[model samples]
Target: MPMSEQRYLVAARKYRPQLFRELVAQEHVTETLKNALRLDRIGHAYLFSGPRGVGKTTAARLLAKAINCQTPLDQREDGAEPCRRCEACLAFEEGRSLNVLEIDAASNNRVEDVRELRETVRIPPQGARKKVYIIDEVHMLSNAAFNALLKTLEEPPPHVLFIFATTEPHKVLPTILSRCQRFDFRRIPVENIVARLREVCAAEGVEADDESLMLLARKGDGALRDALSAFDQAVSLCGTRLRYAELAQALGVVDIDLYFQVTEHVRTGNGAGMLQLVERVVGAGYDLQEFVIGLAEHVRNLLVARTLPDLSLIEAGEATRRRYAQVAEAFTEADLLRMLGLLAEAETALKQSAHPRLRLELTLLRLASLPHAVDLRRVLEQLDRLAQSAPEAPAAASSSAAADPSRGRTAGLSRLSTPTGSTTPQPAAPGSNLGSGPFGPPALQVRPSEKPGDSLAQATQSAAALMVAEAPEASFETLVSRWADVVQQIKQVRIHVGLLLEESRPLRLMHDTLELAVPGEHAERLLRNQETFLITQLHAHLSEAISIRRIRFVVQDRSVAATSAALPEEPEDPLELLRRLQQQVPALQQLIDRFGCEPLWQGN
Candidate 1:
């Protein structure tokens, strides 16, 4: 039966490294072992740990042969590579070496196996300088077996050596590790794996592209053997011309180009674009989980590239690497971190979800919309534009403050954006120990109520008792101005609140009564929800029983600009409200001109 059928040799079996020099990406482990053998400073037990199929067992076997090489390098008396023609090397390779023992601990993990092994260690080697027992999957041994083997491992004979190889080193007992010299093998890098695979393909006369080799290398997860196995599959599926599409389809993996396109959508905050991309991907029959994993990896690469461009260690083809370099330069570090976090979270959600496609689509939408909504850069840019158009005169800016109750005066108010977008330091409130005096936010002044002047006094005292009133002189305008300031503070707290502030425009104040206008009937209902809190904040700011009333909003269309005449009126220019204020209160006129307060002028 065997003679008639053809035997297909797997790439893993055919390309296994037979000697130290042939091992790829593991020179450190081999060179160190060679040096130890040459110096004759070898330990009784040696532990080799690393990812699967990355030469742990192979290195263990090599060590055994090198120790017993008769015609060794002998620079200091021993050699680098074992002499294959030596009695021990030939006997070892033939599976008939008396002193070289290989045990698969995975299947033989019991106290009885350990007891039998303990007994075998008592006998000496017949032909070699040292008796070597190599145990693979040492981590799989039972706790009882480990305990039973512990004493012999700690104090074995000088002529005996124990080699333990495991994919998981932490699972092995610490007591056993203390008695051995340890070597941890790393996952081979993508470039190194691809190069090795290329050599194997050429030797086998298989034609494959660099892209296909990269996909195989990535699929291997750092194991050379796994990469070779994937290579064999690619050879059968595509017959040596490895195209990226065919390779990914064959292996159930996503292509790199898709990742690049998805990242561009995220950077632009295009939700529709992201959803379209997801629909196309799903329609193409790619697995949602596979796409999620690939997307997460792509974000991770971008983050690495953004944070450490010089130190980024990627294993992609030249074209793909250059594309990554361009993407890295385009995104900021903050954007990358946020994207990575979002994608990682999405990956977990995608796994648990029954409708993974829907979840993926939602995740993409979230990523795409983030750039437009809460980005710090966008907020700062808006504020910068406002600042540029702001008037140079402190008075015009100050009047701008008094004109809009939603923009108030506070010590830190300068850091905030004005309605027009400029940032300017605001006057301190009156009685504010904040180092700026009366021109500051007007002290909690109470507007006099007509109910015998004592009623306003009683209300002011009550407000002060409530800790809302600061001790400041009273005036009707001061109370109105301060209440306006509190409204502005709340506006700054949230944009929705700020929009509400615009809708609730201040109308006028008369005899301890304050009135505001709500833009629409719907807005009036919304304002009612927060009426109680709003009144309390106003009382704290006004220190008076200033009632708030909301009326229908009215539109006022003026031919002349509302802010046109802030300066004193001349004969040629109509003498507006500013001239009138100057006529009635000459002292106020000095204050207005001195502080550069733009005067209100009467239009002809």
Candidate 2:
């Protein structure tokens, strides 16, 4: 290489913004400074603060050059942009200007440095109207240095100007900050970064596609300098041309396709596919935590896509945006939220787990195995359809019927009335629990193979049967025998009320009124709050058995005799108890058979 050969300058430095308009995504700060320059409102001290690589330091440098330029503000075309041909601007651009000094506060952050700065502030500008001092990373200055500079910063010479730039404004001394005109910069959007990269590529005669530029922008994570640095790296790796695949590979970025594949496996419930994806991720030498992070972002994108009509919130290329929209159709918003939550947990776990690969595999498998969430709207629509197809029953009759037919003697039996006014039970379907029974049908029987609509239709029929069925007359013994059914019915409506009822017992039964005993006043009060609901449920369940007009609750003493003495003793044998239950409630036998429930007995 010859010494005279042109030296390569990195994109970050080579394309640094020299003018206010050239600074990307910082209009708020730039416009304010430009207005101030046009109005000749130059402040003695200024501060710029924001995230890294978001043009804080660049804005500070631009403001310094503009204020010190020999070109008069009224004569300049842009008003704020310095004339590069002028002696002051040319000297500053060439880094030989004695009037404009840029200092790295990170290295020279001691009390002596502030003392030296104070000494230099007294000297007048040689060739420019103002001597500008731009301090980068001003927060790095120690407390003593900050205290030493505070007085000078607050009341410096009219010819001296101080500009401070820092990523962390909170770390800067409040006293020193109060003296400066503060301007906060914002993170550059992905679109703006991509557009800037495109300009860079065009200027350098390098060819790059949209996807490649998007990848670089996203890799930068809201920082223009970082994105530009990534662009430089991509150009170095791929010569004059850059594509998405090679650029991603060279930069060790996990391809967005892998994230899509993970979600696809989840949609299909393919645990094996998830395992293979994890294996591929590991084989590619991708960090498990980083992969989880990327997957979380992918899930977030899907969530946004599923919830919003357009992809305005997403920052992917047009093709990738279309893919997100297409994939989002397969998932509900709830499912995407759950996936994101799971991925977030996995991300945290991967940070602390020794076996990251195994953790990642377990996480992906869990995501794949996640049950599809049942949409309440769809269920309600199905119910509405079923309701429309079924015959309408009287509202008063339906109100008196049991809500759930599964717990009564007439669990699955449906009945039809003859013209002669006699009711006859409909023949039961083969392999169904429904049959001719003493009581009418509680609910219609549904098979596992039936669609959701069919099941809803059967349910509607069961409800109709419950509404029309005649209540059979019974003795007090029947009410006692059906006490558990009444409690279960209450549980289905309000579980806490049912649980409270479970703790109480029947003390005695009057001609038209019943008195129950509870263990404590708290239980009595809680039950009292639901007295009306309890009364309605009791009337619906034991209307034929008993005609109780009013019910009273009493607190029983702990030392009192057990309430079990009032009711019949349950059979000691599990088989005998089960048989007795089936005899009292035929539906219990069907439930036991359908669910394969085994009877277990506890010995006293």
For 498-517, candidate 1 gives per-residue lDDT tens digits of 45555356665532344566
lDDT against the true structure, per candidate, is: 0.70, 0.78
Q: How much RMSD separates candidate 2 from the native structure? A: 17.2
In candidate 2, stretches whose alpha carbon ends up further than 4 angstroms from where it belongs are: 1-3, 386-604
RMSD to truth, every model: 22.6, 17.2
Best by TM-score: 2
Whose lDDT is greatest here? Answer: 2
Model 1 residue-pair collision total = 16
- Residue 596 of model 2: what lDDT? 98
Task: Output the worst ten-in-a-row residue range by lDDT, candidate 2.
Answer: 433-442
